[model samples]
Target: AYGFKTATYILDDGALNGLSNDAPIEKLRALEDQTFTSDLDFKAALSNALGDDKAKQYEAILVTAAAKMNSVLILCGILLFVSFYAVSIGPVMWVLFSELFPNRIRGLAISFVGLVNLTFAFLVQLVFPWQLSNLGNSLTFLLYAIFAIIGLLFIVAKVPETKGKSLEELEKLLVKST
Candidate 1:
């Protein structure tokens, strides 16, 4: 009348201590398998699965079960999303950056600015995992969305249109007197 089709967690140790239930606490033996009821009455074994790292790993458990969807579908969706994001945001940014500075310093300015942008992109990639783990997904994504809105506002107000204007005109409009 028992099966081991999968790993069923019955004993809740650190966080599981919150639940209190019991059938026969006094007569229970050490060999008895832990039951998976929300209530835990009998004293649990002193052994800890988290072990020495329990303090760090005990925060919040984020369970990600594998999706049953087709692999092709998942890959196609990701590719489409990335393609749209890049096409929508990438070229415009390069074009605007190329047009921002005056001709005299344009090459040097773009290189320096591009380096700064690359650094920030690397930082975002590095910090993203920490943000998701510490702040949770909702707040982490909200932070990025807020920054995106602020960037949009700056682009609209500060960045100029390069449609048909010559480099000289843009230099006059954007560059300031020392």
Candidate 2:
């Protein structure tokens, strides 16, 4: 009953979110292709197969594996945090980029930055999967740390403060830089 309810909820939600109603059937077929056991009672059978003593040993191994995964999890958490901060930084950078240009060139400057952002985003997506696969966990983290540090430095050095400044005042600041 619970499984049926969950499946119905998922199907309805997926349809509402613009997924085709065929999604659930396709997913089920994929699971069948992967040779997953279709028995709804497999949970009970699995517990019976393991027995109590073996289950305890299995649990201990899982705990040790989870402990080793802590570093990777922490790195992932940091990445998520940094990504959130970057989202906040984006608008500020855009505003500052806009302010740095003369009125006649502001649109051009914005378009240039937008293109650069899009290019980098595309490159990041292309590279990141290979980096994770080839570099292993620690090196992948080291790479992210290096990039994060560089981003922090760029923000500090290249980004101008724009808080509470009028567009005319910002223009004066940019003009003084020339």
Highest TM-score: give the candidate number: 1
Worst-scoring 10-residue span by lDDT in model 1: 38-47
Q: Candidate 1, clashing residue pairs?
A: 21-41
**Residue 17 CA displacement from its true place in model 1, Å:** 23
Total clashing pairs for each candidate:
1, 0
Those runs of model 1 whose alpha carbons end farther than 4 Å from true positions after fitting are 1-62, 66-84, 176-178
- TM-score of every candidate: 0.56, 0.54
The Cα error of candidate 1 at residue 87, in Å, is 3.0
lDDT string, candidate 1, 1-178, tens digits = 0111122334324324332243222222231345532111111222232332432333222011111124464457457657866885566776777777777787998899889989999999999988765564446656776886798798788767788988787777777632
Q: List candidate 2 stretches off by more than 4 Å.
A: 1-67, 71-83
Local distance difference test, per candidate? 0.51, 0.52
Query: After aligning candidate 2 to the native by TM-score, how far in Å is the CA of 59 from where it should be?
Result: 21
Indicate which candidate wins on lDDT.
Answer: 2
